[model samples]
Target chain A: MAKSIESLIPLSETAYYILLSLNVPRHGYGIIKYVEKLTGSRIKLGSGTVYTTLGKMSKVKVISVYQDRDRKTVYELTVEGSKLLELEINRIKIVYKDTLYQEGLFNEQK
Target chain B: MSKNKFRPFWSYDVLKTQDWLNDLSFKGYKLIKVNPVLRIFQFNKSESENKKHIINYDKGLDGYPIYIKDGNDYTEICYTKNFYFLEQISDEPNSVPSYNDLVSRNRKIKYIVGQMLLFQIMLYSFFILIVIIFTLGIGSVTVESIPSNEVEYTTIEIMSAIAFILVNFGYFIIQIWMIYSFFRLRVSNRKLEVFCGDGIDMSFTIPKDTILTKEEIRKLRKEKKLIKKTKVAWFYSPDKIEDWLEQMELKGFNLIRMSKIGNSFYFKTGLPRNVKYHVDFQTKKGANYFSLNKESGWKLYFTSYSRFMAISVWGQEYTELVPKYYSDHETKVKHAKKYMWTYLAVFLPAILFVVLSIGMSITLFAYANFENISTWMILSPLIMLVLVVELLFFCFKVIRYYSRVKATEL
Candidate 1:
């Protein structure tokens, strides 16, 4: 049976970034660096948050340890994670469409 | 060369210790090492400037720097059973803050302070129980009652009595001090408010959006005239405290005095200028921690076991400084969570102690039917009674403090 993405509708900012960064296989430090750079230094991942989040996502089959390099465990998103990410992105786009036409926002850019 | 000095600062005031260590550095004494348990820090004589020490805590760290991942080099100094203390030295004009994020830093500090409180309660009760047992067992056995044939018995009893007295006396002092620190933290957390009027005032708020020149600021200060106000407050939340103190200073109240055990601040009205406060939570620190902070512009004005509140006034260009305390939310939450772990650590030992004490009571009750109750055996039940009372008292304190700690969690 295909799992519905309804339960994962409201992903936390941390979880969302972790999943996005996991588009490529990366270890703990690698994921942290990727997230920081991806957000242009707006987001920084703590080791504790990364460790606990990976443990939780692994339990849900969203992410798994892809390989171990230099005694450091590397993690990658699974099929379930990719599906959830796609669904979340679509939901965000729907919200963006509803709000982009509002009075003051996006008017200056146009 | 000035001789090195050491002071015991174990209240988890990481920022204040850093400032103190920096002050020593400026005075020609350089901090070299720290011992957490002994609460002793070693220093060396050096003529260094623009030096600051950064301290970080992590539970499962093994010689790894959690923050300060830039060009700055760091060294692991000392650690307790479940924490690591790492230090970094910087000579740059403005040393980058170790913790730039406030939310995560608050969580980590709450966890550490919570755990420390729990451990303190356990230790206090254990000491109380020991004192009661020893006092009951051999405190008053008379030396005059010794028979001619049993001189050795008298000698043994006297020696045991002396040992019990010395141990209990030592533990009693530490237990009292620790309990006082706990109450101060708890009481301060509940009663913290901003005062601006004749009595304790809570409605005062700092005025914003006013850009005054140096002369205007001085004239305003002269008209208001400096007034001293003292208030007991808990700074369990680092993120809010910095803002609160900053606002107080913005209104011309400069913090001048802080109580050693209680969380009370003495604020004197001063010139309204650009000033900010940074609160850091650390375990005991040595001289080196202070030297690092002194080299920076921060002045260590307040201290508590879990709070190191410092104040600084730089120009508008440097007013947006972040605190260099805990680096991340994980570290912050880890310490607050330790508060719960402390209870877990005590659960088994506490259960065993209660069960054994109950069994001893039952045995003593049954033995009362056989013969004259042994004077020594009678003290066993007294010991049990003290343990139970101490446990009940500790539970009440834990409940009172746990609520305050939970309220401060981000």
Candidate 2:
């Protein structure tokens, strides 16, 4: 049975960035570079971290793996994975809104 | 002028050979050619400055040398089999070219080791067969069957036999020494892997510069009450061994170090704690493999020498929620299968050898008279029978572990 999308909720920072970068199929090194770029150099995923994360996500069917033309192992997010990403983005939006509202109140009180 | 030197077994210890070559270059003798078959080194005397020599085992894709063209600093001096002798003219030590792919380099070493082991096994089997034949000829003949006068061997024949035995004994000693050197090479290769990273990416090598002095080490050792224990053939069943180590930690024996070959484990007495142990097998590990695991707080205890199916022991202390090295069921099952197949491959040939010996002895007993059969012949097969049974048991344990992992959903 496929695991519920909710069970994989609260994706790790590494896992979230990895899934986000997997919009297009990418190999291990490619994903590392993509994640570094996507995060504006804030996150540089090590090859081992990418490899283990891809393995775990592949196990849960959140990501699918295939061999590219050059025989490199490439990964891309699955349909369930896209949905999980969307859910995470929505959750973040709520937190972002609350923080902004609190900042406005603090400014008014000052 | 060219000078020739004979070093019959130089390739067995490559690092030492490299150092020797470098030393020669410093003395103005430049390597011209290597006669691998004849075990000779040809050098030409030159007034050139000291140049660095790098011996690389070239494993190129599609049967070609990887470093075909000369780089900016280093040029190929000569080629012999898979080894390419490279020379750097620049005096700067840091500018000298070296292998960046440690995993590939170690794989080549593993290949050489495998070939040497195969040769040794063949030599040993032939030697044993000759010994068995001689013993049978001398011990099985009855006194009544012999002529009234004992048959005498010629002095030349006796002398030849003595020489042959001496040669074989010397060869046997050389083989033992070669085995020891191979172990030393493995230890050094693993150290290189850990300290130098792949050279392509960032390295997270544990600093060795902060090493404790002898007196400090002795003081620390006394305070910790360090103890050492040896366990042979631990790789045959690594999972059980990991559990055993973890259990020992719970009993206040925290594992501090493991010997180079992963046989001897050193521990220091400490408070009872929960520590998860993982036995990871990887065919090749990149710099990222070490960096990522280290970043995740897993302390690397031991890593086997061969990059081809290398085994590493990693441990992490936790108060709760046992950490999973492979958080997924698929990866865990795959790891178990790797253990099963590796042991199966290693033990299958051993089992066949044992079976063949037993079969040969049985046939010998059936064809020959009971009185003619020697006790030694019978004893040899009996010993092999016990060995085959033990090997089969180990195979069973590995298979069972694989099946258990396969059945488990997690």
Candidate 3:
């Protein structure tokens, strides 16, 4: 599982999920909520981490920053950012099926 | 109380000064008194007490230059050598004229005043020459005569304005160049290397560290031979400092404002023991200072013991592993981002006025300074008018700034 995680762009597991959540334009808090829902709260994006990552992402041009037509900074996935999200989604699909097939008779152990 | 006199870098660093003092003492240069940055010494081994070698150790802003006196003539040597032990107190009870006595005997202030007067004359002549060169040089290119017709005045006025700007442009640039040559510093990063006089090989920005560390404060106390002093840790760069701050909430670093010196921050630590990656820069001087802590500081100074210039551990010493090369290069280019603001801020337009004045004077001079009038007598009123206006403007600016300061304080 760790090997699978390492196969993608070098991002902390939390950053990948937050970037994954921002497939649509999202505000700062919205991204946090979306990451919590998507990762089942397994990855908590701290405020400092989120703000600093947003700054870094904007600097690298991975994400496009926009005003929400009302002055809040709205972040949307650029084509490059979208492609990275696609890779994560595909990896999760593989993991999802592998777990279901391998744990059918091992379910009572939990 | 013997006050010592010292020169610049040459007499100390290049001359192997401390050794020279020992040699001079062996040659009989008696030690008199010592100060922080100077040492005064003299010797009287004759039937009549006389001067042999007057060697001094000095540290000044432009780096130290030493003055040596041998009787009828004197030579000054300047270099970057540590020569603190150039003199030791003499044991003999003696009443001979000290070095201070000799300097008082040699005041050529008369010559200095003459030089200053000559300087004023040359400056005045140069200003007139520059203006004349511009006028005659440009005047030769203009139409032989202004059109006798009334309709041509507009074209003539337009041409005059353009010519005015061109002459002023050259004049102002030259003035700035002069000021820069006279006062712009050529300070090699002094703290980084004790310049060996052979070459300046290294440069680094050591924070003035003006807010002396606790260790530094204690050392200062020891120098003053005091019983105690206080210590504190205030950060310089809050962003880099945030990494070491205990709390998660980013609190800004505190700063103290000083009237004469400007703002400062202070910090202190024990003998740094943390092992981490660092940058090592060694210069011609045997001294090496590196950083491994917050600023990654470790000194391999010659004044220290045998371990001076030795590297303990700094980020797996790789050859030429400079951090952030691409961004650093980008910063090196003077992008002129604030060019217009700087031009206005430094009053470069005044350069235009100065050039205009000089060019006008020279042109008027070459044109016979209006023949009937005495050139200087006639020029004085106009020059005074210009000077008065300039002084009034500058005075207004200074007064306004002071008024703003007073208002803020109130």
Candidate 4:
């Protein structure tokens, strides 16, 4: 039960999906649909959760959001988001390379 | 008690009449049923309040012993899983405001659910309309068999019709749920005053002409006066209708409780161990005898719930028992999404089936005949990839709405 509250910290799944969804400048709803398509209908974000997360992410410089004359905040990943992606890729590579070496397949593959 | 003070309203939603043999106590009676959304309880009292001289009021620790706290002398009234409800009754003249506040919590929840239901209906109807419009063009798509040069009608019409019916059937289900919620909301609102200790009614429909004597009108006037309109704020059964009546009768004075046996209402009243029976004829509108409507006064109702007759009691000071088992929106949303793990069970299979279907459909139409078989064979995987992408896009749209489900408590 205590674990559930900790799991809902919002910056992980919501942030990742929103960042990926808005490869182009997209508004709140358009991001929702894009994420749905990307995930093959796996992740559905409630409207409240969506807006709240977007507001938080924007404040932290993870994603940049601006109004496109129509006054709807169209959101897109920023340089900071790319930095996050690089960090994630490096960590994954370390883990994957370590596993590959431990399994002794690196000798043949390399 | 201050009529406007917000108090703790305990609610535990358990199935009807099933034994909740957890740690619980009853000084006055054993609880029968509790509806959190309605904010009411049904219980069976072994003794009546009128005859019992020593009516001990306790700020008793729930799931423990009930005692009369007179200078710290705590007496255990009874040891059982009988429900004791904690509800504030307004000592003030006006009680609506306090009562409304309590009832409003439920009202807000009910309203949100109703809005969501209406949204679902609109969406279902929109899908059904699409299916119908597509069906209109289905008949025009005729097929000619290239091999035999024979005619064959496309099955698009049949598929369209089936899809239309399925959408309507889904809408029908939502309609039933909407109706049930509507009636439940109405009942909960109407019954608020009874458990609040003031028979509250802001508007009264007193008849202009009466066939009965002046005495009858006076009685109603008395009842109307009992109906306190001044809002002392804070808002907010089953049964063995007879056994409870007999017990109430033994204690003296007549006892009345409200029960619903279908669409209509039934009033079960008892006169001091004398006799117990149904008294629907004595009721007005759907109101039970005096206060025997859903939140009727000082009464217990036994209902056949789950498997046994669940008993519910309403009495003075503590009017209703709402057991909070701690399920909320988050719980439900969590529960729905928790099955995401279960998606693993079908995820691989569904993907494989889709991939296989694409592969077969592509292979079956090599060159659209046979002369250009090699050319079409080379194009097959590309066509399959395009089809798969379209299918995935459609699937994703539907799945996204259902994904990220919020947890709900039961």
**What TM value does the first chain of each candidate achieve?**
0.84, 0.91, 0.70, 0.67
Q: What lDDT does candidate 4 reach at residue A73?
A: 37
Docking quality (DockQ) of candidate 2? 0.04
Between candidates 1 and 4, the one scoring higher on lDDT is 1
Query: Could you tell me the TM-score of candidate 3?
Result: 0.24
Candidate 3: C-alpha lDDT: 0.39
Residues B76-116, candidate 1: write the lDDT tens digits.
45555433444555443122222211212333455566667
Q: Report the lDDT of model 2 for residue B332.
A: 70
What shift in Å separates residue B233 of candidate 3 from its native position after superposition? 3.2
Ranking 3 against 4 by lDDT, winner: 4
Least lDDT summed over 10 consecutive residues: which range in candidate 4 chain B?
B228-237
Off by over 4 Å in 1: A1-9, A66-68, A98-110, B1-342, B345-349, B352-356, B359-363, B385-405
Report the lDDT of model 4 for residue B168: 90
lDDT of each: 0.52, 0.70, 0.39, 0.41
Q: Give lDDT tens digits, candidate 2, residues A1-110.
A: 25698988888777888888877766666776787687797775643346667756765767654333333345667667889999988888898999999999999999
lDDT of 2 by residue, B1-410 (tens): 99998987675556668889988888888899999899899999997656677665533211223222335555778887656677755444223222323335665665687578788899889999887887798865333666737888889998999999999999878778667666766665655443334442332232233234557657767886766789977777777788899999999998877776779887777788899898887765655466557655687887765655488788889987676676556557767887789879989998998899899988888898878888888898899999999999988887877887788674
Q: What is the lDDT of candidate 4?
A: 0.41
Q: Going through the candidates in order, what fraction of the true interface contacts does each contain? A: 0.00, 0.03, 0.00, 0.00
